[model samples]
Target chain A: MKQYKHHTLSVLVENKAGVLSRIAGLFARRGFNIYSLAVAPTDDQKFSQITIVVDVQSAPLEQITKQLFKLINVVKISELDPATSCEYELILAKINAPGNNRASIIELVQLFGGKIVDIGISQLTVMLADSPTKVDDFEALLEPYGIIEVQRTGRVALAKQETSSAKLRSISGKVS
Target chain B: MELTGAQALIKSLEAQGVEVIFGIPGGAILPVYDPLIDSPLRHILVRHEQGAGHMAEGYAHVSGRPGVAMVTSGPAATNIVTALADAYMDSIPMVCITGQVALGSIGTDAFQEADTTGITMSVTKHNWLVTSAQDIPRIIKEAFHVATTGRPGPVLVDIPKDVSNQLMQWYWPDEVDMPGYKPTVKGHPKMIKQAAKLILEAKKPVIYAGGGIIRAGASDQLKTLAELISSPVATTLMGRGCFPDEHELAMGMPGMHGTYTAVTAIQKADLLIALGVRFDDRVTGKISSFAPNAKVIHVDIDPAELGKVRHPEVPIVGDVGYVLTELIKEIKNLEKKQDQSDKSAWLKQIKDWQIRFPLTYDKEQTKVIKPQFVVETLSANTPEDTIVVSGVGQHQMFATQYWKFNRPNQWVNSGGLGTMGFAIPAAIGAKVANPSAMVWAIDGDGCFQMTAQELVTASSEKIPIKVAILNNAYLGMVRQWQEMFYEERYSEVYLSPDLPDYVKWAEAMGCVGFRVESPDEVAIVIEKANAINDRPVVIDFRTDSSEKVYPMVPSGASNDDIVVDPSQGQGGM
Candidate 1:
């Protein structure tokens, strides 16, 4: 029996047109389900960073990683372990806060370190940037407020500190 | 020195040692063709853009070099998509250059415009859309580099007309600076040792060779290792010529339609050393039950293929040639010989299976020439070094089964994609690559008709390749499938013999044509066709339509359930 687990991978690829679709197409073709994917330009203008969260069975991890490397634009891949990585997701929700409900929704937003970003006559839009689990908790707490619309920026992650070790180590101690 | 992008492109191709290019000229590509007229590289104009692509593949199949094809934008680029996909599936190294709309009008639906890069992205190993004329030299170099390196496949470079026509300084890059495109070619020493240990310790080990062996030119290393370990070798269709079929240890092609001995040996093996082969679904019928008892040592250049199908016990990612060379050296150093008593018993069991279920067909009873008989006769008459090509269908299977491939690159076919019209164009390419070698395209009636127009290109180019069409009056393979699985409904598989008159078609194409209906005439007609060295010849062997490819493990069925003869009650276990 293989256990299905969520894996966060950071990929550095050539900043070129159609590179994103190439990566997405690979994931789709290989049947790897993406839980969340985020892409943004890196410090280097020549390269872009893509953070992809995939829900896959244990057996396909090696294959998935290798397949990612097969893409010509993909330069590097770093699997971010949950234990040593900082991961965050941002969500914005619009609640139908009719007067009485507005105060309580605002109170809950403050309790979760969220902000009341926009205010309308009958609705208040709340924004929260936090770990995925906290965002889930905040969404669940505000479910009773009759949320009208919601949007989420998928998870983005980075290692807390760069490990000064080679990405691939030689078994025979001879530099490849 | 300053030069036009088209001139630089031609110079770069010359730098890459390209002898010839198969293609047709059109509007957007005219600038490139203009420079080509003065270039030393010979251009063979093809009937269709698709033929050009397949011709390149056929050339690559024999030459072990990246084949080149060029086409104009839009429909020409789109027409070659099948060949690109076929090359991708079979891992053939090919470079395709497509002329695109000018950079200014790229997205505006300009005349003779298509998103060649976008359309070919998923189908190619990699592709580039050049926006600048200065990038031509580097991109061409990169295109060839990527196409020929690590798990080789087709790469496309789409050049806008403006880019090709624009003036640019000509200088070949000192190095390809693709930081992302490095391939691991050498196996880890420790893993190689581990693989050797496994080989020596195993009682019933099978060397399962695939196309990687041929692509890497590792057939000699593979043969040496197999012989050293005294293991019986079973080749996948892609790996048909990687191992000599006449060798004592050779168990011909394994999987669906595989020889009984070969398929059974894989099923009953205790250890499987898979070299350069991905265990595709067609080869591994039911994944869970495939080589259930065996520990697999999967060796390939592509790491993704390691655990994509069955999880290999020892996964070594490297070039097949390099890995096998190191592995053989490691085994030699270890100086460990297999336990002779147990090894001989395993060999004896395999010998029994080979003798008991040899590939057989009723040649005597059928009045009509059997397709297998045609292939067998063709095999016997051709030179030992003959390069045989085929399109996808019953004739492809018959050619793969009957033809004796004594050397690597002697057999070429669309093994992975199984493209229907691969024969004529690929044969032309092979003949172009090796003008001295005899090349034969063994095709089915259905497959031959799909791309037979390329025969005209062959005639014009003076590529004297011989074609043997197994002219069964039906789409034989599909009809066989419909017979067994679809209750003999036979749907739309019939192809009438008298309709097109293949003989007249060949004569019209400026080639000698012959039709052999009787088994007695099969050899005589093949000899006559073989004698024509001045121009292409097409021999139509009208064959028995009722004959089916046997030893078929119906799609998704276990190897244990292989149906050898549908006429017999529930083909043997």
Candidate 2:
């Protein structure tokens, strides 16, 4: 059996209505799988950045990027490498806590640089923002405590801004 | 100029040089139709939206320009989806504008409300949902640009009814502002040189051409390339007329229903110089074994198509004509003249195959007329410049196999999608495009029933296209499959020949009707149908249903195991 590899792609598109639908429709019709997707407006008002993690077992990365480029609103697709890019995800969770376990949970949160947003009679709402792996570790650690609810925002990534040296081959998919 | 969006729409169409629009007006699209009455552009009202869409497709197939279609919301928009899909599959240039409900009433389930954009997003190359009246002209420009460029597929623009009613200050932009839609029209010089080297070095080369040759107006360039290289050309079904069948080096259409020489030559080739073809499944039976020893040099305008089916040793992405020009130049510069004797063995092999297994049908059946006979007789009687259109099924295969097409755009059929109801309206549209040329539609009993009502439109419009319905009394292709694979337990495939008297139906549609039961009357009625220049004519030629397309590579089978007529026993092989 062939292993299906997962790749994260950062795409810049003209910010407008139904652009997401167009991208989603392309994926669906082409039978490409979406592992995770994050969409947010860029610093510029006219363009938006979409970070998509795809798991298409049958298609290659070049094919996916080529199909995306066919869409009129899609401007650029950048393949974000985990080795050089900064990838982050946010997780919000409420853990069932008694008064005695509250201090230990707070200590764990402080150690991980997370913040306790609210304290309830029997629960504590914790907010953690970090790399996807770290967020997963945090979720695993909090599973010991009775969990009330959990929410996670899909990953958003950007390439590292480095001026030290430029490499001959960049990580961007196909073309800008 | 200050104008309503509907008025500006007409003006934009006029600016775009769209001479005709095929559509049917309803509540949502009433505003767009209102402006058409005053505009100089002609509008042919169709009975169904599907007919309008197919008519545009046929018009585009013949004229090499983007055909235009407009329809109302909901069912009308949905009805046109088949044509959109068909055009998309064949990469026909078409612009379809569907009217939507008011902006505010959208998603409220108002009357005739449908998510037209969402429904058509997958089928269309690009589509726009216009919210403001000011964006109409720009979107229309972009729609035409997108539909007629790159691979040339259908595009749709869904406008709200209120947006059409609103007034706007209209100014046609000089250039479209689509940053992401720049299509590469020129091949890389280095790649062209590499391809030229491959062409010169190959011992056995086959030029497999597709509809892209006609779309890019590259038939002349392809012919030059084929003749200069001494490579035999095998055209796909959509590429029927690109290479003249009379040319000695021309191999006929290749695939399931292709000629024997074409199928055998491709299998034995050492190199395939594929241009503007996607290597469709029908063409490549069992992809793994298709052209087993061939190193491919694939060129197409669409990048995704280059490696979608068959990966190429030299993948060149550019317009077909431009690539052919560059390739021809590079080949000429690389070598002053191609050594003709280098490929003598390959050429001789193709010639031998052509002589051994010519496309043949039993012509002595006196009780029943073979469908191929009807097609051949029609081919013999029609003018050289006549545009041949066909519906899907066994009739389509026979139409393409028998017709001797020598010029580009002289053959039109639903190649990719195999839309059943395509022939009637498409013939109407083709005749409209080439008013001086005689257009003939060869149809089947099953397919003609799908869009027969469009004859009414053709008759009323005075576009005289003669049609011959091969009354096989069944879905001929499906029945053949059932007989071969499913023990001949024919399921709902039969449509009795005499159920709907086609002559009466033709007469009711204001067309001159003729019924020919025997083969003796075939040529006489065809001559009569040809002479009628004032209105559309229909002739019902009741044909035998048992006759099937020959030289068939059975489903999922390798091209190596192609079967000839079963009656001609397998003992020879």
Candidate 3:
């Protein structure tokens, strides 16, 4: 089987303009096929957090990470495993509904454990939380109803509570 | 008592005895520049802000002083971040300053405005956004103090545009006070005694010196200790040139691409006394099997790094220079005995490996030449004490494997970052630091293409550093992979199309140039490059594209699994 690559990058960037563009350009120029990207503020005394997800084998991913670390703004890069972390995504969608079909949209939203955040006479807005891939599936489900304005907060993750980076200190067992 | 914050800043730096600063002129930092124009402090205007950062790094490496870099806000600060990270990783002392938008307009996104404090947090040992004009003197003092003290690294001070321009009462306090910051000065006496006891008791002990030796300015002390113990010494890649490489006990770099002698010596040691060096993965192959039998004593300045990797039997945490001072005292207390563990067996094994797969380039069968010769001859002709900088790749490996580096810090490469285009500019920095010593840039064709523009920096400054380009017409590492694993599906490995004739390129930059086609010409051209003392010289050797770095541990592979000398089928034991 061909080895698909997975990269977990921990970026410490200033929460400001053009940073996302710089990061995206870095990935696009380097030929990294980003599978998922997670951005959030960290609990540090300074700086914000950005997590990039790229699909490639370990060697190329290592190369990507090394290159990314060399970027002037990239503070740190760590390849995190999905198994060790819980990942989530949020998606907002607007679907046009003329009549009784509008109730179907509301029922579908409730069925998927979502909520109607906004409503208009011609269009209804639904918000859902799931995996990014699942968000894609939700977008697909609302396609026939002429869905519009799809906004996704890409994958955000927090490693399982008990096993902190402190716990990971002894991965090689040669130290701590 | 009356002074501008800018004048106060300069006075504080001068009081700190700052002789020089590396920087470029910019708008936001005009206040500091205006004051600097009249100060006794010498300023070297580097071509780029990034160049200033690396120049500071080189100066710091040489002087054991905190090198200072100044820049404007925004891209300038960002540009210096790599050098900041470089110093952070290697524990070099550097003070970086950037002018910011004033406090009133800080978050307003004014021209050249950047959140300097936010951008530099993770990359710096400590950073401050100086708000008040009065804080200027204290902050500059603290920045230097923090940057040079224990676990040295880059410290940043972000001065606002107006704050630097503001008038203030100026006084250079003889002492500084930062209540939260006090580094450990003295090592635990018990721990120092324990490390000395371990060294005394062990039959086979090795002192693994690192860049910490350079940072601590303890090369003379390291040499003394190695002689006192009568043990062979090995160093990490970053540790190269810290101890005189020519010392009989000096085994070259140890790790994935380490010399055979160094690796085997490290493996056979019963006790490893690691001083001021981090056990990077490149040095310690799969950590589990690395020096499995050795009882390790790790001496470092940083407490956090202690027990972080390969937990030492004794972790003596404090300044390296201070710890070494105490260790020498403790050694005087121990009873002397004859060295018992016959390192002969281990030494013989390493010698046998070296002889069997001695780094060689074909003397007779010379079609496409070998890069190995370029460095070997360059190493022989250049002063043994000369500094050598390299761009990372196949050539870096060959430089480490083939070149004899008998002294400390003679070899400077972007080890952790493996940065391309690092060689030319880094050599320029090294030359700037040590004006009398010959500096050579051992670069690969691919890496030379990255930042050779720094040739102008060298030529303009008249800081002469010889460049030796290992001109293999391929991305040698990728080509090796294609040959070994991809069934020769060579894609994107050819660099011939993009490469320029380096000789002409060097000439255009107002430097002497030489081109070598055969292995025999390596020494002659290198000698010629060395002879041209007035300007930098570049020598391009057209080497074979297919040559590979031997004793390779496939990424993340265990230490035991090294592929030695692929061309000769001499596999590792």
Among these predicted structures, which one has the highest lDDT?
Answer: 2
* Residue pairs in clash, model 1: none
DockQ of each: 0.50, 0.52, 0.03
lDDT of 3 by residue, A98-154 (tens): 787898888888877888999898899999998656777777888889987788877
User: Could you tell me how far off, in angstroms, the CA of residue B363 lies in candidate 3 after the best superposition?
Assistant: 5.1
Clash count, one per candidate:
0, 0, 12
Evaluate fnat for each of the predicted models and list the values in order. 0.59, 0.57, 0.00
Q: Each model's RMSD to truth, in Å?
A: 2.7, 2.2, 9.3
Error of 1 at B404 (Å): 1.0
Candidate 3 per-residue C-alpha lDDT over B234-315 given as tens digits, one digit per residue, 9 for 90 to 100: 8777777777767777777788877666776677778998988888888888888888789999888776566657878998
Interface RMSD of 2: 2.8
Ten-residue region with minimum lDDT total, candidate 1 chain B: B333-342
Summarize candidate 2's per-residue lDDT along B478-570 as a digit string, tens digits: 999999999999999999999899999999999999998888888999999999999999999999889889978899988877887665444
lDDT of each residue in B355-439, candidate 1, tens digit only? 7777778867657888888888889988889999999989898889888887999999999998999999999999999999999
Model 2, residue B76: C-alpha shift (Å): 1.0
Pairs in steric clash, model 2: none
Output the better candidate (1/3) by lDDT: 1
Worst 10 residues of 3 chain B by lDDT: B335-344
